[model samples]
Every structure is written in structure tokens, then in C-alpha cells.
Target: MAIGDWSSRMRGAEPCRPGTEKNKGVAVSPSPARRPSFREVFAVPEFRTLWVSYVLSAVGDRLALVALTLLVYDRSRSPFLAAVTFASGLVPYLVGGMFLSGLADRLPRRSVMVGCDLLRLLLVGAMLIPAVPLAAMIGLLYAVTLLQPPFDAARSASVREALEGERYPLAMAIMGSTTRVVLVAGSAAGGLVVALFSARPALAADAATFAVSALLIRFGVPARKAAASGEDQPSPLGQLTEGIRLVFGDPALRTLVGLGWLAAFYEVPEGIAAPYAGRLGGGAVAVGLLIAASQLGAAISTPLFTKKIGPLTRLTWMGPMAILACAILAVTVLRPNLVASMGIFALSNSFAMYQLAANTAFVERIPNEKRGQAFGLATAGLIVGQGIAFALAGAAAEVVPPSTVVALSGGIGAVIAGGLAIRWRGMSPAVGRHTARHLGREASLTGQTPIHAARSN
Candidate 1:
């Protein structure tokens, strides 16, 4: 069968409209529908294109990190420089979030994504120049890093647009699961590629991937207008300020975004994997096993999440699962063997369902125009919080046992999750007043009502 025919068969016929009722002359909302299957979600043509581009870019990004880390070490012969190069890729998230992220909202999303890919291609190509100064190369890499937030925000917004209604959560789950698989696969492949042909060829391959990504996003995704929020702001800084206020000012959005920060504490075990493995009478292989175990758990859990749990019920599960993960991690202070340690790590990561729940809820509440900035702000928080968790956990390990640090961080995460759950009880996935305001303001400005009811995949 042709691909279009296959997609149509998978999606089936158009769903019937929900029946409405009148209570005292007011319209009553219908009950929420069940979540879509993975096949149904993928039948969305735009989503299929976005998913393909996302997978390619995600895999290439991971490979580039490995390749660049090795290259910096090879050229400088300085572990410090190599470490700095590794750190460079992460630090820009804060910069991107605070300053550059508004571009995602202010410009057409396709343009933002395509521009980022093209810019990254150029930056990576510059690194291939033999005569480029090391400092210059690092600066170029930093410039490339700065583009990540806007690019990511664009992609997030695009995914939201492509997979409508209940399928939104399922799409997020699939993407999360894909991220885990790509991390493991890409890291291993990158190491092999670097070993066989050195970093130059790997870097060249990364550049080519970016060029292909640009083409995919440009040709495959439809063009949409920039956010009215962007047009309303006099400057990017103004847009950033408005985005921050919109997220934190609302009770529901604040609670949802907080879940991202809470999950960051769980990253401690993976960060301390090296020392933790050493303490378990295992070597490098053990470290890899422990890390892989955590990702494996997330990958396994993601598909099961939407299958077993209803949308509202899934939101409530975030807190309980977080507490369970933390409780297990804290018990690891008993100094379990390698098998036990790996299992404990896996247990903690299984709670990554909390992340999917949080993201889905946040997206539902955000208006189409503001989605880029909101996702950008939330993503920045996750990256920064995770980075700090790693640094602080590493430092604490010097003063105490690695296992102790792991347990301590887990205990802290439990406390945060418990407090958030109390607040989360009232939060709903429906669009809120903030979104209404954006849609209302946009209609006034554009002379057309762009807001439409979300449809199921």
C-alpha cells in the first residue's frame, strides 16, 4: 500500500463530534475521550515528518557531543580543556532560555528551526578548519549551543500543533522513549565512529545531519504566524519577561513547571555513576550498565504509561511514582551489589512518566503563540537544575560516600514532590485564562480568531 493509504487505514474514519447538553441554558462540556494509540498518533502526516526530523537531529546531537569531546582532548592534550568543551554544550541552555528563546516566539517557528539548523551546520563546518584557533573554535561551538533553546522550543511547539488533543500526551511519551533509545545508541555509535575514523569525519557527518534536518523541517512542516505575544512585546527582553510571568503567575502552570524541577534531582545517581560503580566492586562496564539500566527503565515505562493510565489519573501518578523512586534510591545507602544497584537506578528512572505528564499538562494550558517560550522556559529549568544536581552531588561525594549523596538527593526530591502534589490536586489540563487572554488579544489585533478547539488525533 502507498504510505498515505497506510496512514489513512491506521487512523480509521473521522471521529464523531462529542454530544453536548444544556443545563439551565448553559452548554455542558463533554467528558474527556480516551488517549489515542501510537499507530493512530503516527498517522498524523506532519507529526510523522516532525518525528523523523527530531529523531535524526537528536541522534546526531548526541554523536556530536561524543565526537567533539574526544576532539578537544586529542588536540589540547588537556583534560581541563576537554572537560570545559564538554561543559560548553550544556551552559548555553541558560543563556538561550533567558535571552535567545524569545526568538522562537517572535519569529515564525519553521523559520526559527530552519535557521538554527543552518547556523549549526556552519558552526560545525568551521570546527573542521585546521587553521581555526582553539579559542575561536570553542567560541563557535558556544554560538552553536546558544541556538538550542529556540530550536527546541520550535520543535516542541511544532509537535504540539501536529498531534492534537489526547494524542499530545502520547506523542510526548513516544518522544521521551525515543530520547532514551537514541542516547544509548548514539553514544555507542559515536564512540565507535571516533575510534575508527577520528573526530573529523564524525563532525562532518554531524554537519550533514544538520543540513538534512533543515531541509526536512523547511519542506515538510507548514508555515505558521509568530505569536501575538511576540508582536505585543516591544523587544525580545519584553517577550522573555512576559513568558516568565505567564508561566509563574498562573497557579496551574506554576505547579506543572515545578514538576520538571522536581524530577531533576533524580539525575544525581546517573551523575555519580562512576564513583558509585567503583564502590560496588565493578569497573567501567559496571558504570555503563548502571547508566543503561536507568534509561532502559524509562524506555520500558513510557509506552505503558498512556496504555494503562487515564489522562487525569496519569497526572496524579506523577507524585506517587516520584515518591516511590526516591524511597528506593534512599534505600541504596545499604550499599547494594552491582545487580541491586542497577535495579535501584532503573526503579528511579521508571518514574520518568512524571516528566511526560508534566509536559502534556503544560502544553495543554499554553496558547499556540506562547508555547515556544513556555517550553523554552521549562526546558531551561530542567537543564540547569540537572547540571547543578550533578555538580553538587559530585562535590558532596568528596565529603561523603557516593551512595550517601545519592540517598540525600533522593530524600530531597521526595520532599519537593510531596509538597507539589498538594498543589497539583487542583490543576487541570484544560486551557486556562492566560491562554484565553492570548487568543483574545490575538483576535483583536489580527482581526481574525485563530484559536480553535483542540481535536483528537
Candidate 2:
């Protein structure tokens, strides 16, 4: 399918070719006897490699942040400079997502990912040079991260092709849960690796991981052509703008993206974790524990929710869960104790089911051909929104109490969640019923007892 044709599909035009189902917003149904096990998703060799590479790459990125922050602080003795270095990791997403994301769709997905890994490997390798100025090192870091969104876009788009029918949700849940778990583990491990050895060694390790990731992608993933095919292709900027237009123009897509953007506010507490912990008379350990608690909540809840709840039921719960999370977080403004705040933070993140549901819906509604750009746009919006919230909350905390800023962020998130819930409530019944029945059949199929025939009885 041509790239220009996606807008028509988004606008409810009939599927332009055979095998394209119109109104794919509804969940897919597979026969009970034919249902695939969630574990079977990993049995697909390509997806297994992708999942492993993602975890390794994500861990390396997290580790690099710790090493880089320490290296900058040690070299310059300037906390502000170190902070700027940290922000570079996030700020690039806005530019990269808007201008560079089209490259994910314009190039073969595997090539985009493999090329990104190789480029980052080279950049990080350069940072290891002792003679390189701190300014140049920082610049290299920024350039290294510019490739992140597009790589993520390509990886997510590939998942749609790797997993089919009921397996898609399972794959999404696994990926989401693994990410939360890895973030916590990676952060702590990164700090320890830097402390035990040194920044240079930690960075060298990260660079090597990128090389390994590149190799994994090259060997494991099948080569495929770009999504767009035509004599007169539009500019990259035009493609990105069209992607944005298509997302906002579709009701389900708009609501899903809105939920994702609202998460920016939800993430404000993490940005202010240190100050909030300080306000409670806690130290670095306290900050670590709080972050761990929040991640653990998401890691535990995502898989449980995916296993027990069907997609349709998950949709109904998304808005309410998001509101409850933020509302509970807002209550933390009452100056709760350390233990109490940690519990509340954990409870709030347990609602990761909201994102998982929205993501599944997004994958269902969007055309496979446009998945890269669509995922890119969604991820970029989340990063940009969250980056802004992080900056605003941090800045506001200078004048107001950190807890207050955190609470305000939550309150704002609640308001947004309420709006989404109201808009989405009416659309869930049919979709939810369809998804629930589909999942019910899969569960029964997986759980059914084997029989030797009535003759034995």
C-alpha cells in the first residue's frame, strides 16, 4: 500500500485491497481449539531475538545514563551541567520523533533498527576517548539518542508482523512488563557498575552491548522492504504531518494517544523523586526504594491484568484506573509518611493495564503499513509531554514544595483521564464484548482437560 493511502484508511474508507479488514477497531476472534499460547509468542524465533535485543539495549541505555551523569559531575563539578547531560537523553525525542520518525517507515524496519544500533555503538565508542572535550562528549550523547525513537518505532512495528491474532496482546504485555522490570534493575545495576569499576568501563560495556544488539537484529530478523512504494514520494516532514493528522482524526486513536500523553503528568513524581524523598527526611536509598516500588507495581500488574482480563474489559477499566491512580497520588499531598507514600505510588502504577489496553487498541485500529510512523508519533508524544511535565514540575518545586508540585501534576492527570473516560465509555461495549469472547475461547482451549473417549467411562 502507498503511504498517501493511509489517510483514507484512517478516514473510514473501505480497505483498499484484499485481506484488509475495515473497522479493525473491534478485537479479532480466533477459534477456541486454535488459540495460541502466550508462551508460544516467544517461540517465534524472530520475536524472541527482538525481545532479547530490546531488553539488552534498554539496559545498556539506562546504564549509560548513570555512567554519563557520574562522568560529567566528576569532570566539571557542576550539578547543573550533569543535569543538562541527563536531559539530553529525553529532549532529543521531540526533534527525532517529529522530523526523523518517517525514516522508520521509509526504510526497511530491520535496517532502521540495525543501523541505529551500529550508529549508537560508534558514538558511545567515541565518548571513551580521554582527549575528547566534555562539550564534545555531551554532543555525542545527544546525537546517540536522536536514533532512539526511530529504533523503537521500527521494533514496535515489527511486533505486529511477528505475532498474529490473540498473540499480539500477549506480546505487548510481555514487552511492557519486561521494560518496567528492566528499568528498575538496570538503573541500580548501572550505578553499581560505575561505582565498582569506573565510568569508562561502564560506557565501554554499553557500547559493546549496542554492537551485540546490531548483530542480533541483523542475523535474527528477516529482511523486508519499506512500507511506501511509488514514483512520487512525499517529503519526510509531509509524511510525519500526515501521520499526526491520521492519529488525531480517528476517534479510537485520538483517545488512545490522549491517554498516553496524560501519562506525562503521571511521570512527574519520578522527576521529583529526590526532592520528595528529601522532604520526607529520606536519602538516596529512599529515592531508590520509591522508584523501585513504582516500577514493581507496574511489572507485577501488567502481566496479571493481561492474563486475567480480556482486551474489551481492559478498555472499560483504562479511564477509571488512570483516574484512580492520579487521584490516589494527589492524596499523597497530605504529607504522608515514607511508607505510606511508597505504597500509594505503587498502587498508582498498578494501573499500567490502562496503557496496555490502549496500545492493543492502537495496534488494532492502525494499518500495518503505517505502524512504524504511528508508533513513532505515539512514542514521541509521550516523551515530549513527559519531558515538559518533568521540566515544569522540577521548576515549580523551586518555589513551591516538591510534594505540592507532584500532587498538582496528579490532579491535572486526573482531569485528563476523566475526559478520556467520558469520551471512550460509549465505544467500549461492542469492542469489549468481542474481545472478551475471543479471550474466553482461548482460555477454555488452554485449560480444557484431555479425554480418552466415553468408552473408558
Candidate 3:
């Protein structure tokens, strides 16, 4: 949709009228606009540079993951170790996010990002050395992932700073779409490399990407606030707590985080089902197809997320919408086999668009200063939620079929998520005490519609 559409809908957006206690969740109006035309994402020199760096790094992430999995399998001939290689990397995601990501806002965005890239480069390079011990390879993987969340937070906060107002949702859409594309591209490229010359070439390629990504960050991003002034600051751990506190303090944010947590729970089967598929004799290529199918569906349905009315609204259909999405994903696990699992994943992804819209709505609802922590907390919630789901699914794989557990989890997630969405969809815009994100762009100060306002969120 056009900026004008979102502006009109958001401006005139009303709170839910109180009837039962049910309407308490979504009865607030969105505060005055954050900005007018956020569509000019690439217009920012720094963001464009980061975007390029991000795309390259995205490819590298996939390559590293694939190469590591293959390398571990080749060395040990143990499925459990290979699975550990894939799953254990995520442990740092939870820990780093919980204890470290708060440094994103507290530190210079540039230094945090550049430092992360270099750290990952060195770790990945370590993995590329053939003479390295098996434990050394695993250690390097853990280190690389441990550094992920802060870098992720820095990039997220910088995007909000770069694209104020109507452009924020568009930026999210672009980023989401880019992520899907990267997953597809990276996974495919990783598989091809593994098939051709084994995993070392892929690891080296990933390391190369990290090295260049670090260099580009130095060239493109501005220095940290403390570094620029030579001032000491609070620890990253302290900053992380502040971010968490900011997120929980706001009503709107709480709703967003809640739903995000549910979404994370709902998503684990998508990953776990791959190994399940492999166990059913679907093989590596089958596992790849399963991922590709779902993502393809997600890619096609991504545009629906730019909805102007937003999911966090009185007019929003987001609650049942989210429920339906989860129901679809869960039911995918009730299938007869892996092929059915893949098909269900593809179908479920289409239904999952509602969740994406809900996420964008949450972003739009949050104030400027808190956006860093809010988004960071939201990201953390997602990681935490997914971890729970993954762990549960993995455990379930030992007792019952993974597909069955996936379906059960999906069903439970849908019921809970649907109920939560229904309750929160009644919440008003709740924009009390909003913060200014930046200097206003001259383009839409009067709230005038753009000349080229062709509808395309």
C-alpha cells in the first residue's frame, strides 16, 4: 500500500470501545505519525552499505552452517554429532541475546557490527583449517554464533534510525523478503558446494565473506558514541537489562513480545521436520526441499504484511488470522510422511503472513528511543521461543515421531496464539509518551500525499 494509505488509516485509526474486558488489549490510537515516506530505504548511504554487507554475510551464514554440518558428519559418522553441530550453534543465540545484545544501543553501532564481523571471520577461518581438532571446529562454531545477537541488534536499531515514519514498515518488508531470499540462495549454494568439493571450500568462502563484511562496516558505519567522545559506558550486560526493561514496561510492546514468543514456538517444527524427513529416508536433498518449499510460500505471502490497518488494531483481523496460521503449520505435522511434511510446510508459510503483519504492527506501535530495546527484546523473544520449540521437538523425536509432535505443538501453539491474538487485537494504539526518532524529512511534513504514491507498502 502507499504511504498515504497507511498514514490515513493510522491517523484516523480509533481505539476499541470497551465492552467486556476483552477489548482492553487493542483499544489505543497510533500516536501522530513517526514520519511520512520511509520507502526511501536505499537512499541512506550508511544503510545501503550495511544492506550490501548484510546480504553477503547472509550467504556466508548459510555456507558456514552447511559446511560445518557436513564436516562433522564426515569426521565422526555420528548422526547425533552432526545434529549437535546444527542445533548446538543455536545455544549461543539464546545466551548472547539474554546477556549481551543490549550493547547495541549503548555502544557505537559501527564498532559493534565491525567487531562482530571480524570475530566471526576469525572463527570461521579457524574451522577451515583441516588440521584442527574436532572439538576445535565445534568451538569455533559456538564462538561465531555467540557473537550473532549483538550484531543483529546493531543492524536492527540502525534500520529504525535510518528509516523513520512510513518507511519503517517498508524497510521491514524489504528486510524480511531479503532474509527469505538469502535463506534460499545460501542453502542452495551450500548444498552445491558440499556436493562438489566437500565442506572446506564452503567454510573458506564463508570466512571470506565475514572478512569483507568487517572491512565494509569500517568503511560505511559511523563510530560509536563512547568511542567518538572517548567516554566509558555501562557494560553490555547492563545495557541489555535496560533494553529488556524498556520492552516490558510498555503495554503495546508486551503484546508484541507475547505474540512473537508464540510465533517462535510455532516455528520449530519447520526446522526439526527436516531431520525427521531424513530419518524417514528423505535424504539431504529432501531436507533441503522441505525448507525451500516452506520459504517459497513465505516469500509469496510476504507482501500481505504491509497492511495499512495493522494487526494491532480495532479493525484488525490479526487474532484469528494468527490462529489460522498456526493451525495450518501444526496440521502439517499430522502427515503420513516427509513429502507431506514439505507440502504442509509450504502451505503453512502462506498462512504465516498474518504473523509477519503483526510484527510490523508492533514495530509501528513502539516509540523511537525504545525501538532499539523493543526490537531487540522482540528478537530475543523469538530466539527464546524457538529454542523451547526446538528442544521440545527434539525430545519428542525420541519418544514419538517428530511429525506427530510437530503437529501437536502446532495445534497447541495455534490455540494459545489465537486466544492471545484475539484478546490483544482489541487493544488501542496506546502511543502515550512517544519519542521522536530523528529530524523530519522535508518530503511529507504537512502529511501531504506523495506525487508517486503508487500502492506498494
Q: How accurate is candidate 2 locally (lDDT)?
A: 0.75
Ranking by lDDT: 2, 1, 3
Q: How many Å off is the CA of 151 in candidate 2?
A: 0.8
Q: Model 1 off-target regions past 4 Å?
A: 1-34, 229-231, 426-457
- Give the clash count for model 3: 13
* Tens digit per residue, CA lDDT, model 3, 205-292: 8899888888888988765462213245456566566666655655555665676566655566665856677667887677777778
Name the TM-score of candidate 2.
0.88
How many pairs of residues collide in model 2?
1
Candidate 2, which ten residues in sequence have the lowest lDDT sum?
1-10
Comparing candidate 2 with candidate 3, which one achieves the higher TM-score? 2
What are the lDDT figures for the candidates, one per model? 0.72, 0.75, 0.63
lDDT of 2 by residue, 204-227 (tens): 888988999999999999998886
In candidate 2, position 199 carries an lDDT of: 87
- TM-score rank order: 2, 1, 3
